[model samples]
Target chain A: MRPLIRMAWATSRRLLLLMSPLLAFYLALMVVHQVTKRGTDIPAIAFTCMFMLIIVSTFQGLTFDVEGFMASLPVTRAQLVRTKYLLSFLGLLAGLALTLAVAGLAHALAPGRAAAPTPEELRSAVALALVDAFGLFAFLPFVHAFEPSRGILAFSLAAILALAASLAGWGLDGAADLFRFFQRVLAQPAPALGLIGGLLAFGLLSLSLSTWAYARRSF
Target chain B: MANLLELRNLSKSHGAFNLRDVDLAVPAGTITGLIGANGAGKSTLLKLVLGLLPLDGGEIRLFGEDARLGGARLRQRIGFVQESPTLFPLLRVDELGEVVAPFYPRWDRATYRRICDAFELPRKTAFARLSQGSRMKAALALALSHEAELLLLDEPTSGLDPLMRRDLLDLLLEVIQDEGRAVLFSTHITSDLERVADHVAILKAGRLVLAGAKDDLLESWALVRGGEELLEGPLKDRCRGGERTELGLTLLCEGAGSLASLLPDGALQERPSLEDLVYFHDRGKESLCAR
Candidate 1:
């Protein structure tokens, strides 16, 4: 393995061990919620995992004061940013996998516990898993770019504002009608391309901001 | 010879205390001990050199290149051990190696192993659980293992036992003997500096009060004792404060050159030690009127 990759793996292993109990607890809670609520859709559990992944990555990723101590080394700022991004993405994947295994096992064992989920429901589950995973993966490094202490509050506010805007946009279709027209436009291929383009543009903007911040930050 | 490191009018302030116009340099392949009292800007100087704190004014150059604007390659040549740095408690001994090893291009695994063995550090033990002395040893092990050209050590020996302090100093001396490498070590232990320091710099209230080669500082001072005649006349200017006793007055004066002739008859003259010179310089500025 490459040295950067090896370092990421070594750092994650210990943290992952520390995280195992919390992962198990989160899984157990999701299983219980599914059993009692009589809802079999996996999308909800995956969505929750997205939030968990962000919180975990933000706290765990920079809990160490390694930056100040190790700043004298020959490593570049670009490499450090890349390593952190990779680690956050890996955490997202691991969180998703753990959720699926725990939830799937619970559902399998407790027969007749939930109404059979539809094919559409399963598809939505997979889609939500991918979307949330990638979305948070894209966003995690920006939060970390601010320094961990400030990053926690900054990312939380950003996430809250995004969630509020999304909720408001969802409500706009009935109340404003113009939002319904925009949603229809977004559904079409050409318009969807524009939407994806906007997301890509934002991702690049965040990347640029994070790179600048990391470069200027004293160790 | 040009300095391995130089600070030109560098200044930084934290709250009311200001480190002002602090210009200093360490010639290549020499040990320069930074002596100061509490809040005397010793740690601040080290932090500025490492770019850990933003400079309020002036410039710092490491090996003739601007350190503030330096790149990763420039950073590679320097090593630092902070007075009270925060270490990653989550990492075990070997785990720390994994984290730090990738940062250095020329990291030597054998050297690291040797240091770990020399310090008797358990590979499995977490860093936070180690004793204070052991933590210092471990930090030293890491700093020395990188083979850096300049070692910036901030109070590296302040908390160690006598044996550990001696060992660390000896290790540093051994490293210095190889030549081409240098050390900017800060400590309150004047005796330690006396033993191995090639040069000494004294900082007082965020200012560079005195700095020069150790021998020059020592050789330039004369300790004298005499009666009221020594205290009453022109000889008063030479007195670098000593306690007044009924028997006589003890004093430190600038070198034996022209100053010796003015001392009263029966006054003793002896060369001051590095510690004596630095102590009087740091604490007795009131007695030294600029000529």
Candidate 2:
């Protein structure tokens, strides 16, 4: 019932209404892919879905010009920004959890159709999710500052440049190799903590940039 | 009169336009009409007060507290209805209330419901689907339901029909019966202000040319009408602005009691309306320069 949480809940409900069909369609597809023992690796698909959901939800959450209405309320710009960040991260986490939970449930229900997902595959999926989330730092400010069309363009450009840079660090196999390289790095404790610390620091910077960009705007 | 809201040396710059050094006070138990042409910064001033737009420089004191930074605490005591009410477009009349209610600790849902009923607002209809009058009424009802001490309304009557405008003005008069509540209403429609305004501020190009009690201002100014020949010369010199209509000549000037002896037969003199004030002042700038 707190104002900030209420705003988060309100926004989440709206986004969920829009996201429901897209999410249901994807989850059904995931279930069928699992049962039919399909072509693509399950973890890769899950990572891709998480990235899409996080980015799409970010766009949906901010597309409305509700600043005038929201600012007029008893909430601060910082609180509004916090709601956005909270809703986005919560979307990412929920999608990942729901995919795993729903897939596990499907596999359990139809045991004859598909084998239980391996722990290694789940771990790799988790690593991929981490990388995708880390990539979000590149364009979180864009999401706050620009409209959807421009924001998505900036995000696409960032993704392309990131992939190009990653190819030099890993092999030419691109995303799969990038995933393998990060998986190896995450296995090492010191480097894993360092990556997380870097992500946290980057996240704080993104938050600051987002807040500054949002505050400058007049409704 | 104790001022409930005061804007001291307020200024804001938006690219090509700047509102500079405006000082106005709204006392309790009175309605202050802010009148201006389009793009004259009426909405901008209102937004700055409500904290929707940050002030580049100056101080806003509401209930005697520094509101220059505009926050929830300051906004809670003020109810604002923008020209068209920028609420969530998709939420129905009732649903939007639920979202807005939690923010206002003093929100009264029962009173909101009563006002909605009184306005005959259709709670089930999409807010966008409602007629302009109905939409404005819904917005006004919502603003009143919060029990805010001061209401800042920007152009609340610009688009309504004559009947609707009358009803809206009447409702506004009724709301201000509680002496703790005051209103700062902005509109270009001087007639609406004539019906309800106690104080009037006329803005021209982002600055207030005139601001004070309505009756006192009208009492001090005069409108003179006569043949074009008698009014054309040095009398035009004394008049702030003049126009030669089909009726011959009309002039707006101060101190008409002294000028009465100078006018020829068939000359007419009377008090100026709010419309006359704006029209003469606007034309005064151009006509005076041409002369």
Best candidate (score: DockQ): 2
Reference A-B contact fraction recovered by candidate 2? 0.57
Q: Write the per-residue lDDT of candidate 1 for residues B1-291, one digit (tens) a residue.
A: 568899899888778989999889898778999998888989889978887666889988988898866756677888778876556676787777767777777777788788888777887888888887777777787788888888999999977888878888888898888678899999999989988899999898999988889888787777777775677667777666554468876677775677767877888777777667666666573543321
lDDT of 2 at B69: 53
Per-candidate count of clashing residue pairs (backbone under 3 Å): 1, 0
- TM-scores for every predicted model: 0.81, 0.89
DockQ of prediction 2: 0.56
Prediction 1 TM-score vs. true:
0.81
Summing lDDT over every window of 10 consecutive residues in candidate 2 chain A, give the lowest-scoring window: A38-47
The lDDT, on a scale of 0 to 1, for candidate 1 is 0.72
lDDT of each: 0.72, 0.76
